[model samples]
Target: MSSFRLITEYSLWFILPALCVAGAYSWLLYSKKGPWSPLLNKILFSVRFILIFLLCFLLIGPLLQYIKNEFEKPIFVFAIDDSESNTISTGVAKLSALKKEIEQAKKILQQEDYTVDIVTLSGKLSIDDITFKNPSTNLDYLLDKVESNYENRNLAGTILFSDGIYNQGLSPAYKELGFPLYTIGLGDTAAKKDIILKNILYNKLTYQGNSFPIVAEIQNQGFEGKDITVIIKNKGKLLDKKIITFSRNYDLKEVEFRLTSDEKGLQHYEIEVVPLEGEFTDKNNTGHAYIDVIEGKEEILLVASSPHPDIKAIKSVTDQKENYSLNIYIPGITEFKNEKYDLIIFHQIPDLQNTAAEILNKYGKDNSSIWYITGNKVNYASFNQINNALKISQRGQQLDQVTAVYNPDFNKFSLTTEEASVISKYPPVSVPFGEFKPMNNAEVILFQRLGNVQTVKPLLLFSNANDKKVAVFSGEGLWEWRLLEFKETGTTKVFDKLIGNLIQLLSSREEKRKFKVYPINSEFYSSDPVLFETEVYNDIYEKIYGQNINLTVTSEKNEKKHYSYVNTENSRFEIKGLSQGIYKYVASTILNGKKETSEGEFLIKELNIELINGTSDFDLLRTISDKNKGVFLPVTKLSSLPEILKNSSPQSIIHSNEELSEIINLKWVFFLLISLVTLEWFFRKFKGGY
Candidate 1:
């Protein structure tokens, strides 16, 4: 409801003219003495006077002040935890009781005219479904969701029902939610008689017939003087076994197991601990890992005109890998056994002495991939004729000291974040001072940077052209790069990874599929997205779009599901969530009116960090509530929380305002003046005074 009033502060400016016009009109009417009676004359004069006065007074603008009350119900929200730990921490009863309390709270809030929303936090927030089996809890992700949903709103407060057991990311104590937060701690703090398989560690790749050690850690609580047997098995075949004795109530033990890999391809191993008398949560008692065993060693041929430290540096790294057998041959001494090789690395090969061309022709004609490393000794003109991947034109024997700058668009494979950083800081290498031009399609990993100017010239790259895989390193000083890497990081893993990645990319078999569908990451965690990307090329190797591909996923339990995905702008698709298991997929599409199919397998590992420490982190919960102007309510005290909110919400909507402007437009003034003048005219005509 609203009220209106005419603003009369400036009425004095219009009042004088109104009175003068009224009196003048009265005189004009009275001056004309007519046959009408005195009463008629007075009435006529009064009508004319009122009409004239109204016309004069309307010159001043009038305004109406209007106010309205808007009732806005306060928004109240609840985020409930539904992770696997909920069932472990005396939470079954508390969760049941809390559900009842929540129903009661919803009724009270609705009756009090509050907008309520309840969501379940099971590694994510959901309103219609609840799954308490999520393996991990990410409090940071949950809080971020809450902020995104209620920011800039009258979010009176929020209620969180969780066990304070977060295993993934930042704790809740560090968040500034900008509103009141009330937490109800679930789970028990009492230690129980339990045993857990904490973690398993092993190399992800190994060679056939090689023995690799697997390390695992176990934790025991309240199981003193008890012996448990741990067994390692692959495909249900026993590999190794050990018995561990827990001497103390709470103990952590690290054990090692050595097993021989006799098979090829991906292998799965399960490490399990025999349960004691009364352990109920058997999920965490077993750990598993996967290792890929290569069948045989692959030979790599290294050709250089003479002895150099760079060759020694490269040899040291390749010798450590059991899968690659490296052979080095200087031009004058001996010839490399080109009998059967997987890859060949040529260092400054087309020299002014012209000694390395015959060896280059011997191995380069074959289908095996080649890597070219150039330095001051490389003859630029002869090098251009030998390789068609890149062309360069420079001044006579001038050298360029170029540092390595990583290219962000390299997507062939991946380099660790730490390795990229280390390579960027190492000393510069010597390249020809010239204009470098690449004529073929190349995926560059490192670019050349002279001083501070980053250039587009490729310092290290991989290319696939004319049915051959070629990699190029346009400069050298790898020996310096290796020594600097070791001096700084105290290990050559970073450098080895850099070179190893290039070797793997160039040495791997080429893909001949026209219609291809592959996962961005073959190995995924339960916390990560299952992402797939596709590539469909026409006859001439040009990428085409608008392809409809059908896919079927089969789980280890033989459950199969079908899905269809058309390409996005980037030719990608995603399944945002999946359970932990081994999944194989077959993707097929109609290309050129023929069906083409590609199949692959991917693994999703479960993240059980939240279940390791099952005790309640009540201190973290208290810190969150204390800093956010809220109350920390335990499960026993949860009933009193709604009462606190009830007391605080009376001032939820203290006031509101609105606008109404019907009279302020001044249209009513014109209608009132016309009505008075019309009435006077009708009366004059009836009294025969017209």
Candidate 2:
């Protein structure tokens, strides 16, 4: 039972002031009557006596009624947290026990004539309902609701059941509710012994033959000072492996590996750390990455009406370092066989003879990539017999003099929507060009207008029809860029990058049967299993099977992961995940138990931390309970909580009551009277109140 007091007890102090005033009034009347007062004095004394009687009546604070009901009953409230994190380990069992205890306590409170309220902490609010079903746990939300709803009700105490893992709510301990908190902790306190791949970092895009870095983070618990091996493989071939030690307790270790693009198109890389002994799940031990590689080297056929510096300049740029191979065909002299190149560039071919027109048509039909460069000598008549596919006008005109303009700003050309996919990175600028329209299947890569000429033509274009690709340059001034700007460097790096990019774009043919493998990281352990898988795609993007594929996995430590393909009824080819060390894998189809291979390679990374100490530390629970004035009970003692709870009581409510006369002192009234007298005196002297 809680204690209570009444306001009437504080009114006793008013009696002294009333008696003083009455006595002073009686004395004053007697003194004014010269100590011989008669009826008038007696009447004044009687009035003082009545005033004293009234004052005493006011002093005796009254109450209509006063009652006290005392019993051993105590109200109890159970606030339970039912969040997702609470579902770990033996949480359900602990929660069940907590619920049973709450029910038992509710019965006890009811037997003692005390009210019990059950509040569930979840995504929403509830009262007196102990179903305790919620998708989330929010302790602060429940407390706020309780504070708002139960403000007038006298709460004896509160009990809390949770895992101490609060993500969506405020701290319940921070609220100053003047109540004792009894917390029941749920879930396992021990740190779990496990290994997890924390992260995998790699580039989104890579160029063919370029080396890219792959970084992996390995997090380990309970394993320290123990050597672990990580292995990497592609398809099934072992690429690399490394062995490393881990730190005590739980720590994150980083491993890096280098991956090279072997074939064009999309390349898939898988990196995995070998599973440690006594680890949880192996799913987190591996990660996957993908990159797109466009073919860079291309064979280009150049056909021109006359040999000029423009052709030489374009050839010089294409021929360096085997980026692109350029073949020259003069219009009248050479009757060329059209079988050798991916793209064919035409420079001012003036005559549309039957043989040349037929060749052009054949080139277009064969899907041979082509480029048409227009100059003063060329007219529509020269290209008209070729089915007018080039969109060239037929009127030929001779120019007296054409000045080459070297505009650095021509390199900043922006790509249209159609060209953005392939030509996204290159800046486009106006190049000097003559008149010509791109073919129906052609896309303009660069455009320019000739000396304020109303007709603007494509300076560079690509066509996809007939399996052919064509690039058209409508001017001859590009050669001057090399001489005026590049000098001995052939052309500026920007121009080189442009040519390199163009070659890459034109030569990119989706691989008919190709597979690429990459290791997530470079280092691996010999004891760790190497993971390798290939995403096989047909020429048209339909998934295909590499049945009975043989993958030869080799490790730097002489470990191997060779395996014959065991078809899993799927197109993907995979090998066993590996351990610490640098490893590689080469995958191929096996015929008669022999490796009849295509292509494959990969790398495996190692874990960095040692495994001396076990993962997890349970000291946090004790620390938290100690800091918050709560008891940290063991899991076994959870069922004996009712007795401890019954013993605990609500915090004492401390109040300091003062008498009314003490609060309303006469000194304030005396000061006021003195101020009024001074004001009256000042008014009499100066006609103003002070």
Best by TM-score: 1
Q: Could you tell me every candidate's TM-score relative to the true structure?
A: 0.76, 0.34
Candidate 2 residues lying further than 4 Å off, grouped into runs, are 1-194, 199-222, 233-241, 247-271, 278-282, 289-339, 346-367, 375-388, 391-471, 475-690
lDDT of 2 by residue, 476-537 (tens): 55665555545544545555555656666666664444444434433334334444455444
Best by lDDT: 1
Candidate 1 lDDT, tens digit per residue, 565-646?
7875664687756776778899999999999999988888877775676777777788888988888888788767768888
Candidate 2 CA-lDDT value: 0.55
